[model samples]
Every structure is written in C-alpha cells, then in structure tokens.
Target: MPIRIDRFENGPNDVLDLKAGTQPHIVLTFLATNNEQAFTQTEIHEATDIPRGSVGVVLSRLEDRGLVRHHGRYWAIGDDERLASYAAQQAASSASTTDDYYGESDE
Candidate 1:
C-alpha cells in the first residue's frame, strides 16, 4: 500500500503528515516472506530498505499500535495471527493470479 501524504496549512504554518510510511507495510511484507520467522533490526533494514536508526522507531510505533512485538533483539508479528493469516492468503492469491496469467502451474 502506498502512503498518502496529507498537507495542512493554517495561518502561514504548513504541515505534512504521512500515512504510515513504507515501514509497517515493509515489516509485514518481510514477516510474510520469511515464513513467520523473527527478524532483527539489521535484517529488517536489509530486507525492507529501511535505515537502521529508523527501524527501531518504526518498530516501536508498530508495537505501540499493536502490530508487532519485540523479543530480545528480534521482532515478530505480535499476537495478531489473523493478520498473518490474511497476509498469507493475499500472497497466495497474488501468486496464483500471476501463475494463471502466465500459464504456469506447479502441477
């Protein structure tokens, strides 16, 4: 999902707010891609193209928002099994569509 930027101007003051930058989406993508494995900040940075410094901030925000949780030095998709299931279903649907469009089959 692309982030939507909202801009506001009030009496000569301009502010721009981003709707959850690539961080949350990236983290979810990484987790889904990794088969529910826990990932470290370094790994998230490498996989998601997010900076090391920013990963912590994003993870913290996600934690606060009840999206992800930290265990030691690694992060995992929090107790939200439904979200993980949904992501997996979406991924599978996308892959199936791609295969159908390309006339490819695992069988």
Candidate 2:
C-alpha cells in the first residue's frame, strides 16, 4: 500500500513530505549547495540535464517562491534559510515514509 504523506507541524508552518528525487528537489539542492555562484539557463540545462524548457519553468516557480533570484543573465539562490528548511522538511518526510513502508514507527 502506498503510504500517506508524512507531514509535521512546527508552530504555524505545515511542512509536507516531498519526494527528494524529483527535478525540483534536485535543482533546489543544486542551487542551494552552489549558493555562492550563479548560472544561466543554458549552463543549468547542461549541468542538470533537466531539459531547457523544464529549467525555465523550475526557475520561474523558484523565483516566485523567493527561493531563487535572477541576476542579470544568471540565476542564483535567494534565501538560504528557506532552502535549508525545505530540504530538512523533505528529509524528515522521507524518513517517516520509509519507516511506514517497513511497518515501523518511531514512538
């Protein structure tokens, strides 16, 4: 059976569990890790192999969410804290989902 989404509550924030292997997750992780640098669409497409069109869409969403910034001809990370928080939330959700898949729960 498929496991229900694992979510956690932290005060006012409701964080949902997300699959970490998705293109968005991968791109987010990459951008976050290389926060000190910037890259153009072509460069990102080459490095991530995410297809040029998808790269543009991903960048648009991330920019709207304030997770990334567009500077001149390149894109760079916007908020490091949000990126870290998102990654952490995804990780926690994944862990619980794994435990559920194994019919185990950490009490």
Candidate 3:
C-alpha cells in the first residue's frame, strides 16, 4: 500500500529561506490584512504554503528579530509600530533589489 500525505512538502534538501523577513513579512501582512489573530504553526503552514519545517524556522527567526511573539501555543504579530517600520525597511530593500515592473511614478 502507498502512503498518502495531505499537505504538500518540499524535498528534504530544499533550501529554507525567509528572504530576510520578506517571506514572514508577506505572511504577517496577509494575516494582518485578514485579521489580527494568533495562529498555530500548522495554520501558518497551510495559510502560507510554506513547508512545516520552514515555517517553524521562519517563525523562530521572526521571533528573534522581535517581529513576532509566541503566546501560549500560538504565535502573533509583534508591536504594530515596530512591524510597520520593519516592513517598510524590508520593502525598501526589495524595491532596491528589483526595479519597479509596475512603472509606478513618484509624486
């Protein structure tokens, strides 16, 4: 008999990268957009489409950077002001790394 897995997972040797808060930043932004609520790792994994292992690692790095916090068994976004500043910096970095494909004009 063959085993059936539910959630899709990356290979064991796949590289894990949060892209210096880019991944988690995007995830947090989406979660915040939906609503500010604590979610378990499994929820985050499914919501973000990130491998379970990578989700844990990314969450750990985010916690270390004070971008997120663990309360009880769930995790939540950190301070709003702090998150805003951090996300701004990450966006700036992303912008500098890639040109604006949208052709946005400065006011």
Candidate 4:
C-alpha cells in the first residue's frame, strides 16, 4: 500500500513531474506524511534530502496551487481533507494487511 500522489498530474503545471531540481520528491513525501503538521522551510530542508535553495521555489509552487500555506514560520497543508483521509485509510489498510499476513493477531 504505497502512498499515491493524486493531485499531481502530467499537465502544464504539474510541478511533481517538472524538473524541480532534487527536492520535488522530498517535498511530496513530506507533505504526504505530515499534512497534519505545520512546518517551516528550514524544517523541511533539515527533514528532507532536498537542497536548501530549492525549498523556496518548491514551496512557492505548492502554495500557489492552494496546496500549502505559509503562515509566519509554518507551512501547513491546505484544505485537502480528502487526500489526508485517503492517506490515513491507505496506512490503516496496509497495517491490517501486515498484521493479517504475519500472523501477529488472533483475529
């Protein structure tokens, strides 16, 4: 059950597919994992393997599309509850599959 990025499509403004240096993947992964948490550019740089210079551009693209918000020093996910809920459900399903296959639970 891998996390699939749905908002990103192979279109004109698909930053995920564009050559955004080496940070797009990092930003995507970070957003997918911590959509519920607010983070700063510095925090994103430290947490990810992305270059420091590319953080601003990547964040800007995400922000422009109403995907992320930059408030004070925190960059939070925008109003995309469906994506968050989908991720959570995928995680739960994966966990259940692992438990069932590993024979770790009785029922």
Candidate 5:
C-alpha cells in the first residue's frame, strides 16, 4: 500500500477523510445509503460482504461514536450532522481520485 502524506500547510480546514474501504466506513456507508431501513448483523454482513464478526465489532464501535443506532438485532445510520459533511467529502475525494486515474479526454 502506498502512503499518502497529506500536508496542510495552510492550516486545518480540510475535509475529514473516513479512510475509504475501511470496515467501519463501508458499514457506515451501507447504512447511510439504506437509511430508510435497518438490518441485522447477518444481513449487514451479507450486504457489505464483510465478515460477520467484523461487522458486529464495527457496528459497536460506530454506535459508541454515535454514528449508528440499533434496536434489538437491527442497525441503522444515526442522525449525526457530521455524517453529512463526511459523506460530502468522501464523495468529492472519490470523484477526484477517479478523475485523476481516468484523466480528461479531449474528445
């Protein structure tokens, strides 16, 4: 894996990166996109293709941070305002990375 050293010489106003492809991030994204619904650990594991144990652990961690909510066996994205900004930044980063990789075409 290549290390990306982000230098913010202009002071700290940059968007907070959720570190793409991480288990927690993946689980959060899945719940966010399906905000209208909730799922159990098994369902989330199947949907996100993450290990069942990992899914449970990640969900617990996210809940501790108030990023997700649960009722019995079901889990859903929490109403954290920070999530809005995080999602926006993540989307922007993904787009920029994709554009950089594919590059612009004159045609």
Candidate 6:
C-alpha cells in the first residue's frame, strides 16, 4: 500500500508526542495515575523500572516542557491544560477499546 503523504501533511503535528511504553509516557502515566501524591525520582525509577539516571533526565525534560512539576525531591503531574485533554483522550480511547473487545452493554 502506498503511504498517504497528503493525509500526513494535513494532520496537525502539534499533538503531544507521548507514545505508549516510552520513558516519558511511562513516567507521565504513573504520575497521572497517582496524581494525588508526589514521589521522589528514586521512587519513580523503582516503580516504573526505568534506569534511575534516565528517570531524572526524563523528569527534567518534562519539567522544562511544563508537563510535570517538582518541589524539593518530589515530583507530580503538572497543571498544563494539555494534560487534562490528553488524559481524557486516553480514557476515551481505553473505553472504546474495551467496548470493542467485550461488546457494549445495553444498560
């Protein structure tokens, strides 16, 4: 099949660059899931199984982008508006996949 170059060109490219299983994605999802509390870099590394050095680097990058915030040794999800929309999109996508897999209920 030929690649649709026109479609690619027409689509917006400013979308968040997060992709499943990426270091940033893994870290963001973990923090977003446990947004009520902050964690240290070591904790994030242990929980996400990413290298400790990589975790710090990823967090620094995310902080620079305003996608995450930190205070002292603790880090938490950021308040960026894009994050809320991204989370909603993720939830909707998950729901759609689940419905497709198990069939939607009539209730």
lDDT score, candidate 2 = 0.72
Worst 10 residues of 1 by lDDT: 9-18
Candidate 1, position 75, lDDT: 87
lDDT for each residue of candidate 1 in 21-52, tens digit (9 for 90 to 100): 56666776666556558989998899889888
Per-residue CA lDDT of model 5 for 12-80, tens digit only, reads: 553333577988889988777676789999999999999988888888888877899999999988878
lDDT of 2 by residue, 15-35 (tens): 222357777666776776566
Count clashing residue pairs in model 6.
0
Write one digit per residue (lDDT tens) for candidate 3, span 1-107: 54345323544433344453576765665444434578898888888887788778778877777667788778877776867665566566566767867577787
User: What 10-residue stretch in candidate 2 is worst by lDDT?
Assistant: 8-17
Clashing pairs in 6: none
The alpha-carbon deviation from the true structure for residue 83 of candidate 1, after best TM-score superposition, in angstroms, is: 1.5
Worst 10 residues of 5 by lDDT: 8-17
- Structure candidate 2, residue pairs in collision: none
Residue 71's C-alpha lDDT in candidate 1?
Answer: 86
lDDT at residue 34 of model 6 (Cα atoms): 71
For model 3, the local distance difference test gives 0.68
> Which 10-residue window of candidate 3 scores lowest in summed lDDT?
6-15
Q: Rank the candidates by lDDT, best first.
A: 6, 5, 2, 1, 4, 3
lDDT of 4 at 15: 40
Per-residue CA lDDT of model 6 for 40-89, tens digit only, reads 99999999999988998899878978989999999998988887766666
Q: How far is candidate 4 from the true structure (C-alpha RMSD, Å)?
A: 8.6
Give every collision pair in model 5.
none
Full-model lDDT for every candidate: 0.70, 0.72, 0.68, 0.68, 0.79, 0.83
Off by over 4 Å in 5: 1-17, 84-107
Superior by lDDT: candidate 1 or candidate 5 = 5
